[model samples]
Target chain A: MNIVVLVKQVPDSGADRNLRNDDNTVDRGSANNVINEMDEYAIEEALKIKEAHGGEVTILTMGPDRATESIRKALSMGPDKAVHVVDDALHGSCAVATSKVLAAALGQLNADLVICGAESTDGRVQVMPHMIAERLGVAALTGARKLTVDGGTLTVERQTEEGYEVITAATPAVVSVWDTINEPRYPSFKGIMAAKKKPVQTLSLADLGVAPTEVGFDGATSAVVEHSKRPPRSGGAKITDEGEGGVKLVEFLATEKFV
Target chain B: MTFDLTSEQDQLRDAVRALGRRYGHGYFVEKAKAGEHTTELWAEAGRLGYLGVNIPTAYGGGGGGITELAIVCEELAAAGCPLLLLVVSPAIAATVINRHGTEEQRKRHLPGLADGSAKIVFAITEPDAGSNFHRLGTVARRDGDGWLLSGRKCYISGVDEADHVLVVARTEDAGTGKLKPALFIVPTNAAGLTRSKLDMEIVSPENQFLLYLDDVRLPADALVGESLDAGLPALFAGLNPERITVAAMGAGTGRYAIERASGYTATRKVWGGRSIGSHQGVSHPLAHAAVQVELARLMIQKAATLYDAGRDLEAGVAGNMAKYAAGEAAALAVDTAVQALGGAGMTTEYGVATLLGAVRAGRIAPVSREMILNFVAQHVLGQDKSY
Candidate 1:
């Protein structure tokens, strides 16, 4: 079995984040960039499948040149190889456009299975697997909390508001793993060094048979018109108790309809 | 020539930093206070291959050199769970074995070191030898085909956790009629090997041991290489990485301190909701410490690069200097951080004070700051040997 994991590079989650004023996109330099945290689970899940059966794990990510960091990080988690779809023209891509380009690359690579996080922390566009699956005309399982794979069948425990639903799909399928699936393993020092030698095939929009006009901002079906920061929070009320403190608290609570 | 780490190194740093954050200072202190080891973290890190990074690829390692291992050390330290064993075990012992061990020994130890399944602690410091390898009292004399080794080593770290010890002993070279440095792989469970723990004040999961090897007989193959003569160069090879990794640990602890202080001062308001960080008094000292730490880190990078490049002589000079700079910087950084936190800094809950003794201890151990200065004074400054 050959598996490909889709990952994304996002600004450090703990760092201060800001958006570009000119457009609605995030300002990349506001902080450091790291592999999207949720994708770590995807890498872990793929590694688990490889360990259980016999197969190779390949990490697939799309972004600018620096996105290679994401690929290397995922590869460090014991992926056999990587496919980095890097191109400046790929910026400002919508989830649909991203899935199309990724599907094209997956098509070129002949991936038997594709796994990814349910949602990207940066984009929060949970439609990655749907778009990729639609494009490839393959089955997709999203929000998978538990997963198992057999010879030609893949089973997933789809998380729901009620509980969980077991879903199974045939070969050449896409699955979006939930963070609860498994704890992502830390990349060993050897894994980090060995990742340097692992093959990373870089692709561009053209290389994936994607036209420039059909990718990036122009190619997207939907785009953010504008984005703004949330207003800063104001200080809350602080009370001083000199006398009748209990009575004052009761009065205030009653006045605020809490009592 | 670029000061910035490559994209790959940056990722390694970020990943290790994340790992460190997962097991914060709280966990580290709890284990230390209970006199327990950070077994989970160590096992996880080792299993992840963070430990044997400097070992060769054929030995089931990452094929990286001291440069990568130093990064791992610093990142872990920055996360407040500094793994001191990393310095001795992988950085020193693994490098020595890789460079000087026979193929059989490498096959036995290197793969385990690479995967973190096996650990090999380093023992060179002796009660009488101190910093002087020439004065080492450990003697390994041939008894038939094997050797009888006897020595008392002090300040050996993580002996309890180690499977084997790369013992630095002195052997008489019959060919040259001279006493030269020799290395032997002594099993920690060897018949005559005994270890006693020393009480330490420093807040760390690793413990120091006083090792006594009395008439410990070893097989002829226990000697690392075929020749006992390839001693000094092999010893120096391990020392360079040791110094570099220790510097990385220092710089990392310094970073940990500065970050803690900065976080506290940024939020802890005083005098009418004004952050204390607004005062020039607290901020400048932290800033100065940050500058010094950055400078030391740059030197560490240079030293590691030189060592990785096989420029041993240049690496030796730089590694010594980097260790000196980093030791002082860590002490300074920790001190400044404590001052910035005022009373909160001393509070154990704040986690800043836990590093104080450890950072100060950094100046005196593995190799003292004075020894480094003496080296620089003699080698770089063309001065008379002070020691």
Candidate 2:
């Protein structure tokens, strides 16, 4: 099996994030860029499948040059190699454009399977796997809490609000996973050192046969006209309870519809 | 001339910091207070190759030099889990064996040291010696093809956790019939070897012990290097690495203390609406300690770089100075942190006072600040030895 995992470099969700005032895109210049949190789980899943079945695991990422840091970090988690799609024209590309570029890169690799996170922390759209799968004309197993591969068949326990639904697909499928799948491993010292020597193939829009006019802000299907800072939290109602403290708490819960 | 760590080194530091934080100070203090070792953390670090960063790659180590090892030490310490055994086992025993041990000895030991599965502690300080090698009472006498060693070592750290102890003893010179120092790898379970734990005030998981080697017999292969001539140089080989790593650990502890205090003071409001850090009385001391810690860190970097470059003579001078600065800085930082935290710092929940004993001991153990000053006075200043 030749598996491809999609990785993204995003502003750390734990820290303060902002948007550029000029075009309202993410402010990557001042932010601490790290591998998307859920993408690590995807990487772990891809590595796991490769470990059990004996295949190559390749990381596929699309972003600017700084995204190489994330690629190296993901490689240290035991991936075989990486394909980095970097182009200034790829800037401000929305989910639709991203999936198109990624699909093109995946097409060149001839991957039998592609794995990715259900949603990115920054976008949280939960649509990249489906979009890429649609573009590749392959089956997509989205929101998978558990995945099993046997021969050419793939089975997944697709997570839902109530419970999980069993889904099955053949080879040449895109599987997007939830964090419930498995725990990720820390990079070992040897892995970190070896990652420095691993091959990282860099490609641009032209290299992928992607025209400059097909991506970037000009080709983006959606645009954010304006963005603003989230309002600071205001103190909620405080009750000074006397002897009826329990009754007051019940009343407050009822008023807030939490009871 | 550049102050920046290589990208790989930076990645190493970040990785170690994350690992340390995952365990955190709470786990460390809980283990220590329960009279248990940080066995899980140590094993994980070893498995991740953090423990054997300085060991040769052929022996399953990272093959990096002391600079890499120091980063591991400092990052772990900064996360409030300083492992003293790191200074002894990897820094002292591993380096000495790799540099001066015989090829057979290296083959037998380096792999284990590199993988963190084996720990070899060093034992040289004796109750009677008091830093004076001339007064060392530990003597090894030839018996057939083997040797018998007898002596009492005081304040040896982590003997219980190690499988072997590198014993430094004096042997009779065949040519001159005079005593000279030699190193022997003695198994901790060797016959006639016994240890008694010392009650210490430090709140640390590692324990110190008084080691008694009474007629401990060992095969001739136990000796490090090809001959007795390898003894002195082998013993000296471990000193600079030991001093440099210990200093890195001290500098890390200082950084930990200052960070804790700064975090507390910045949010802890006692008067009016302003935080306690708004007052110069509380903030100035922390700032001062931070400056001192930064200075000590620079010296540690210089010393480690010089040592790794194989300039042992210059490294000795810098290592001593680095140790002295770091020891004083660590002690001061912990003290100032406690003061800044006020009543909260005295409580174990705050985690500042727990390091008081360890930092205080740092100024005295392995090599004391006064002894370092003595070395600098004689070597760097061309002054007569005071002792």
Candidate 3:
């Protein structure tokens, strides 16, 4: 099976993010760039399947030239090659437009399977895989924990709000991976050395036969109105003394709405 | 010089983690209990070019340095299968052989050690001498071109598992009244070498041993480097790597404990009609542990960076500091995790308590916390040495 994994370069999950004054967009200053965390699992799962089944893994991502650092990181994880759909305007691209761009780029590879994270840490709308599936006209499964391929058929266990749901799809399909699927692989020294020489084909929006207006902020559907910090939690009531103080705390709690 | 890990260090961390996860904690525990080494994990790691992170690429190593090797330890520890032998074999013994061994020694030992096929455990500490290595009583007497070694080593981990034991012994000349330390490779099957397993309560796979080398003899080639006097610098080169590896192990233990607590408290609720995790009492400690673990992790990475850049002095200080921080962090994290789980924490099923002993090893062996404090006070702070 030939697999293609879609990775995104977003702010580190732990970074503090904010909105910029111009156009009220998210200020990328405090947000350190990294390969989306969930996407790490996706790349790892794809690599595992490729290693088990003897296939080629092509890491696909869309961003500016600097985003190739994320691709370089993915390539270091035993990916056969990488393809970067580079566009300066692609920054701050929403999931819908991002999916469309990735679908357009992935359509050229004719991959048997395309894997992606259910959602980027920056924007947790959880819509990319399904949107890419719609654009590519391929069956898609989201929140998958386990994926198995036997002969040309694919079976996947997807986590749902209720429980887990098992889905079967044809060989050529798109799947969005949950972070719980598997631990991501660390890149080796040899992989880092070799990734320098690996083929990372860079393509512009024109190369994918797509126009600039079709993606990026202009094409994005959702808009962030504002940003605010999560209010700090209130300090709890301290129970100092052991037994008698515990009774006092109970009485205080009974008097308050907390009881 | 730039003291950063470069991209290669990052890659090494990832690869080792992947391989480690394949044969994780469960596998490690089983092999450790069975008195067998995790040979599969070791071989696979070697095949992936990890066992030789700091060895020269010309000698079947990845041609990186101590930083890369340290990353390997941290990643594996995080995966719950920290390779203690990596400290002695690849990091210390292999490093000495590569840098100071004769051409024939390098040809015979480097490839095996690099590939993780031949396991080497280095012994420097003596029971009576304690950490004052200069007072060590292990002796090597000249017998023509060969030497006879007699020594008793205590609390040496992985002696039973090692193919070759690199014993550090002193050679005393009656006339000069001077004692000089020498490094020797004594095969486990060497005549008159007897090892009794140490019954340490720790849960690690490698067991400490009490080695009794009674007149173990070897050829002149068995001596590592030039002579007893020349081994100190070579020995010091390997120690920083060991420290880095230990720091990584501490980080791993901390991460494992924190992860357990994080998963437990994230859903284990109580009052407010949910899990008690909704209360600040449980959540705050977990959060604090998280922050400390991250800080320790940064230090581990920094030490690794300096060591990989060939900054020995900086690496030595950083490695000790990082190890100290990580050890404390891991101990606190595990303790807090146990407390968070409450009654379930003490239960073996939870596995959090199992980490307690492993993390404690970081504080005691390799170098004690008191010893590190002394080093910082004297060398780092310019204060008078207490010991």
Best by DockQ: 2
Report the lDDT tens digits of candidate 2 across residue range B132-162: 8788899999999999999999999999999
Provide the TM-score of chain A alone for each candidate, in the order shown. Answer: 0.89, 0.95, 0.87
DockQ of every predicted complex: 0.64, 0.73, 0.39
**Model 3 chain B weakest 10-residue run by lDDT:** B1-10
Task: Provide the interface RMSD of candidate 2 in angstroms, 1 decimal place.
Answer: 0.8
Top lDDT model: 2
lDDT of 1 at B265: 90
Residue A242 miss distance in model 2 (angstroms): 5.5
TM-score of each: 0.90, 0.97, 0.72
State in Å the error of residue A90, model 3. 5.9
Which has the higher TM-score value, candidate number 1 or candidate number 2?
A: 2
Kindly report which residue stretches of model 1 are placed more than 4 angstroms away from their true locations once superposed: A29-31, A56-58, A81-112, A134-140, A150-153, A168-172, A197-220, A236-259, B1-4, B175-177
What is chain B's TM-score across the candidates, in the order shown?
0.98, 0.99, 0.94
Please say which candidate is ahead in DockQ: 1 or 3: 1
Model 2 DockQ reads 0.73
lDDT by residue (A65-129, candidate 1, tens digit) is 87776687788779999888999897788878887888899998788889999987777869889
lDDT of each: 0.88, 0.93, 0.82
